[model samples]
Target: MTTSEDTLESHEVGLAAPPGEPLQTLTAAEADGLELVHQWFPAPLTVRDGSFALPPEPAWRAVVHAARRHLEAMVGAVGRLECPELGPLTQCGSAWLIRPDVAVTNRHTILSLLDDVQRGARTLRVNLSAEADGSAVLHCPVTRVLYIDPIHDLAFLRVKQRGAPQVGLVVVDSIVTANPVAVIGFPSHAEGGYAEPEYQQIFGDGWFDREGRGFKRISLGRLVSTSDTLLEHDCTTLGGSSGGVIVDLVRGSVIGLNFGESRDRRVNLGVPGWVVQQRLAQLEGSI
Candidate 1:
C-alpha cells in the first residue's frame, strides 16, 4: 500500500474525518486504478471558480456536457438550519433534486433542520447553483419534510422549484471495485476551530469564496467497496459534503447519496442506489 501522509493528514484534522484513527493508505492497484480513471475523467473541478481550468480531454468534456443541465441547477447547498440554542445556522449539508419539486439529503441533516423548526424557526432554504462569478442563482425554500428513513441515513424534502432539472438515477445490484465515480457537493470547513492551514490542505484554496465558504465541487474517485445498503468510495469530501450525490461517471447516473466518512477506513459512506430507489418507491406509494 502507498501512503500519502499529506492527503490522510489533511482529512484527519478536518470535520470529514476525526483525528483519532490512524491514517489510511491506498493499495498499489487502487492508486494505479485512480490514475487511469483520471486519464479519462481528469481531476476534480470547482463549478464557478475553476471553470476555466477544465481539461480538454474528450471523455471529460463529453460527460460534463451531458450532465451539466441535470446537475448545474439540481444539486444545491442545503442552507444552515436555524437553531436558537446554537444561535447560528447549524447544519449546512448538500441536497439534490430527485424530482422537480422534491429533494433528498441526509436524515441527520433533516433532523437538525426539523429540530430548529420545532424550536420556532421558520423558513428552510436551499441555495441552488451559482453564476459565473459565484453568486447564488436561486434560493429555493423547502415546503415540507416528506420522509425520513428509519433504517438508513436518508431524508426527503419537498422544495419549491422554478424548473430545476432532476438527476437521472440507476439501481445497481453490485458495484465493481475501481469503478470510476464523482461526488458533487459544496464542501466547507467544519464548524470547529480547526486551523486554516489544515482546512486549506484538504479542500484546496480555489474552491472557496471570499467569506471562506465552499462552492460546488466535483471530486472524482473510484468505488472501494459496496454492500446491500452502503456504497463506499474514495472520493474526497469534507464537513458539508453530507447528502451529496455519488454519480457513476460512465453511466451518467446517480448511484449513491453521501452521508459520512470513516476515519479508520478512509472511505466515504453512502446509501446505495438500490436502497434509495426502493425507499423512493415506498414513499411515492404511500403518498
Candidate 2:
C-alpha cells in the first residue's frame, strides 16, 4: 500500500513521546547485544538471486552459530503477505504466527484485504520459511480476518496451518528500559525520509529487490521506554515492518508488535506484549 505523507505525519503526532521524558542510555549488556548484531552483518556483503551472501569470517560464523536458534526463530515466526490489488510488489506487512493457525499483523496492513474478503475474495496467503536453502517454504492461505482491534493498530487472522511455528511471548511486566531487542521482518524503503539512507549504507546497493525492498532482516536496538499499552524503541524500521515482532535478544521471546514510527525515525512504537496477550485472550474466549 502507498504511504501518504499525511499518514506518516499522523504517526509522528501520535507516537511522539510526552514532553520532558528523557531518553535512556544503553547499559553494558545492551551494548554487547548491539555489538553482536554488528558483528553478524558486518557490512553489505552482496546479494545473489534475492539472498544475502554469508560473511566468511570465522568470527562472524561463530557469532551466527551462537545465535543461530534465535535468528532462525525470528525468520520462521515472521512471514510476508502480498496483495495484488494493493500493488503487485506491495507487501501487506509482516505477520507472525501466534498459534499454529493464528497470526497477528497491523489492521492497516490488512484493511483492503478485509474489504475483499467481505466481497468473497480469497487471495491472501502468507509465505513462510524456516531454512535458508529455500527448502521448507510454507504457503498458508489466509482463511479470514479474525478481528480488527478497535483501539490499536493490531489485527488477527486465521490461516490454514502447515506446521508453522508460533513465537513465544513474554508479558510486558518483565520488560525494562535498556533491554536490547531486535525487529525481524521484510523492510521496504523508508518513506518518511528517515531510515532509507542508513539502510542503503548498511545493506549496500545489491540488498534491495527490483521494487527496492529488502528481505527478512534483523534490526537491533534497545527499548527506550514503555507504558501501559505502548513501547518506544529505537530499532530501525521501514514501511513494511508493521506488525513485526520486537524480540528480547537475551530472552528470545517476543515483547512487542511494531506498528508506527516518529517522523524523525528515532522513535518507533509498538503494542506492548501484555496488550496483545489480553486481546488474544479476549478473542479466544469469544470464539
The Cα local distance difference test for each model comes to 0.60, 0.62
- The candidate that achieves the highest lDDT relative to the unseen native structure: 2
Q: Write the per-residue lDDT of candidate 2 for residues 147-232, one digit (tens) a residue.
A: 98866778888888677355433434368565567676666654435345544455544444566545666665667677776777
State in Å the error of residue 138, model 1. 0.6
RMSD values for the candidates in order, in angstroms, are 7.0, 6.1
Q: What does the lDDT read for residue 126 in candidate 1?
A: 60
Pairs with backbone N, CA or C atoms under 3 Å apart (clashes), candidate 1: none
Off by over 4 Å in 2: 1-67, 85-87, 130-136, 163-173, 190-197
Worst 10 residues of 2 by lDDT: 1-10
Candidate 1 to truth, TM: 0.70
